[model samples]
Structure formats: C-alpha cells, structure tokens
Target: MIRDGERVTLGDTAVTAHATPGHTMGSMSWSWRACQAMTCKAIVFAASLNPVSSDGYRYTAAASRPIVAGFRHSYRVMQSLPCDLLITAHADQDGATDRFRTAPGACRALAASSRTKLAARLRADGPAR
Candidate 1:
C-alpha cells in the first residue's frame, strides 16, 4: 500500500510509494524526484519481497501476485508520470533499454498498450489455467 506521508529514506535518495493494488493486498510502487521532475522508478512488489512463503522458497508465482498487480497499476500510473526512463528489478521479460528509448509521452502510451495486451491474456488464459 502507498504509505501516505511516509517518506522512504534510501541512502541519499528519498522515494515515495504509490499504492497500486490488484496483485495482492499491499502492492506498492515507488516514484522518485529527479532533476526537477517526479518520475516513476523502481517498483518493489510487497508479495515478492515478503520473507514468508508457503513453499519456503524465495520469490515464486504465489509470492508474485503483488508484483503482477503492481504492473497493472504501474501501467496506469506510468501514463501520468513524467518518466523518461524505466527500470526493473531484472531484465528477463520486458526486453532491454532499447525498448523504452522514446519520448515520455510515447513511452507512456506504449506501456499502457502493452498492459492492455497482458490483461487480455490474463483474462483468457486464467494465469496458467
């Protein structure tokens, strides 16, 4: 959940979380202030980051519900964020930096469109059903 008024102190930078649930009960994504602009940066999923898991492993599908949901909500937030760059915890699925080397407006539009496709697949495939 987006901790209202709670400033995230990370070393020299302080970031803020914007609530973006749907992946789980408390999925939160972060935004940082950068060079006179407020930008959406790294998004840490609560479920994936959580220490406890049913199978006693690290990040798994069940633990990633919030991560998935974070993406859905992030897609919406990205539209409004003045994001010039996009970062992920890892780059296994969403391509490389070459994918987002466009204007902020274009990037936002592209992300939103991609999310629509993912949503459609999720509904049709039932998350591996």
Candidate 2:
C-alpha cells in the first residue's frame, strides 16, 4: 500500500489493488477513496495496484510456472482498471507530479524509469565474460 498513511478500512468502501509493472520487481499503483474523482464520495474508496511478473514469486519449478502464469494474468487485469490517479512508491516519478495527475500518466512515468534502470543494468553487466 503506497499510501500517505497507514491502511484503513472505512465501511467496506476503500482500498483496492491493481497490478502495475515495468518499473521494479514489485511495482504497484493505488487509488484513494478520498479523491474527488470517484463519484461515490459518500464512502472512502481506494485501490492498491502492483506489478505481475513471470517470476512474481520464488518456488519449486512446477509451482514457479503457475505463479509466473498468474502474474502475467494479473498484469493483464491491471490494464483494465481506471488509472487516472498518479500514485507511486517512487517519489521522483508519479509522486513528483502535482497533487493532480492522471494515473495512466504516472504509470507511464514509472515505466520510463524502469526502462532507464534496465538499460543501466544491461550496460553495467556488459557482455558477461
């Protein structure tokens, strides 16, 4: 939960998850109920999103395959979620944006950062000898 404070439940109308990857091993995107965007303001509603990967978890070969498959499916699921709120763990990207920013935009920023890091890693480990 990459929220400002501790996780709290309000009348079962808060906190949700969405898978967002391409940033880190376990990248996620979240939405809060307090935000005015949500039409149902009566109740505090929020979403918690994370990245799903082929190797989301470490386990036996047989189990690993299933886990990886599940992660891939989870990633797909996040794609359909409403991503209009920019909320990220890394303050530099989405978190850096103004108080009001689109979730998809934030996600894009996260993806860019992830690419940058991946490129750097590849460069650092040039042609393993």
Candidate 3:
C-alpha cells in the first residue's frame, strides 16, 4: 500500500505522491518539477475531485464520514500543491488538452470547485437519517 506523502523516483525525476481520496479511497495525485535550462515549472497531475460513486452512496451518512473526511483533506492537499501546469484525471476537468497553456493556480481553482461540489452534494444528500 502506497502511503500518503511518499516520494517515488523514476530515473532522474522524483515524483511526490499526494493522497487525494475523493473519487475513491485510493485516489492520488502526483507532483513533479520539469526543468528546461533555467526555467522549471511545477506540474501536478491532480486526482479526480469528483464525487463519482455508485447511486447507493450517500456522503452525508455516518458510513461515509471517512470518505468525506478524505475529500476535505484532499481539497487541502490539492490547494497547497505547487502547480504551474494542471492536468486532471479527466480531460474535461480542466480542459487539459484544449488550448494547451500552462495555467498557474489551477490546483487552487480545482480544489475550490471540489469544495463547492461537495457542498452541493451534501445539500442534496439532505439530513442524515
């Protein structure tokens, strides 16, 4: 099992793994720096912040407390990442391929959006029974 805050090295590049378990219990995001001479840009392959799950799943239930906690932690992790370029688990999440430009602060935006989505889902979930 890969624990959170582990740095794995692939040849010359070391990628830091951050556990962002919103989409799933094992969801993760990878962060690394790519340098071109004097210019090094921070790249983050962010995990899917979407609350994708089965129809039977309800985030407000006591059973989902851990899941919701993970999501909250994930939001903080995503927001704190050093991201100069953004790539998400899904293409449409940030339009990773569209226009193809490095957008800083994307991680913060992604996390903020996830927070809103989670809030909406919780609202939709209604009061816990």
Candidate 4:
C-alpha cells in the first residue's frame, strides 16, 4: 500500500498520495501533474467523502468517534491542496467530469464546497458521544 505523502513516479509524472481515511481507514487521494501539449495542470484524485459501513463495520459502531474525526481531517487536507483539477471517487460528488471538460480550477471550488458541506453534516450528526 502507498503511504501518505509518498511519491510514486510513472513515466515523467509523479503521483503523491494523501491519506484520506473517512470512507475507510486506508482510503487515499492522489495528486499529480498532467501535461497535454503546452498545458500542464495539477490534478487531484480525491478519495470518497461518504461515510460507509457494512454490517460489522466499526464506523457504524458507537465507538467509531475517531472515524468521524478522520473524515473531518481528510476534508481539511483536501481543502488545502493546490489542484487545478479535482476528481472525486464518485463522479456526482463534485460534478467533476463535466467541470473538467469545461472549467479548470473547478476542483478547488469543489474542495472548499465539500469541506463546508461536510462540516455542516458532522455538526448535525455530531461525533459519537
């Protein structure tokens, strides 16, 4: 598995991993630079923001307070990135696919928006007491 902040190179491009353990403890987001002709853009493949749990998943348990905190931390990390393109684990999360074709820097906006939304969600749901 790739560790957080580790950089892996593929051809001339290098991808850096950012740990975003909300959906799962090992969830990660990757950031890299992509070049097309004369254009070079920073891209981030964002990890899922949705909180997921199976029948026995710890996240669903009353003791999973840390997991909820982790999600908040991940959202903060994502908001701090300097990415020109932001692609989420789910396409509909940020309208990334369509925005990628029409607008650059959409990812930045999406990141901020996601952070805001997540904060509100967490506030409403509250951390496990």
Best by TM-score: 3
Please give the TM-score that candidate 1 achieves against the real structure.
0.48
Candidate No. with top lDDT: 3
- lDDT of candidate model 3 versus the reference: 0.83
How many backbone clashes are present in model 2?
A: 13
lDDT of each: 0.48, 0.41, 0.83, 0.71
- List, residue by residue over 1-119, the lDDT tens digit for candidate 1: 33733678877677766564443446554556444366434432221111222443323247656655666665666566555554433343244454333345543654565566556
TM-score for each candidate, following the candidate numbering: 0.48, 0.41, 0.90, 0.73
Model 4 TM-score, 2 decimals:
0.73
Cα lDDT of model 4 by residue, 1-129, tens digit: 779999999989999999987767788899898999999888888777765455444443477766777777787777687777767777566544442422555555665666666556556554444
- For candidate 3, give the lDDT of residue 102: 67
Q: List RMSD in Å for every model shown.
A: 7.7, 8.6, 2.0, 3.5
Q: Candidates 1 and 2: which is better by lDDT? A: 1
Order of candidate numbers by lDDT, starting with the best = 3, 4, 1, 2
Q: Give candidate 3 misplaced runs (Cα > 4 Å).
A: 94-101
Task: Give, for candidate 4, the lowest lDDT window spanning 10 residues.
Answer: 94-103
Q: Of the pair 1 and 4, which is ahead by lDDT? A: 4
Candidate 2 achieves a global lDDT of: 0.41
Off by over 4 Å in 4: 52-62, 94-105, 111-128
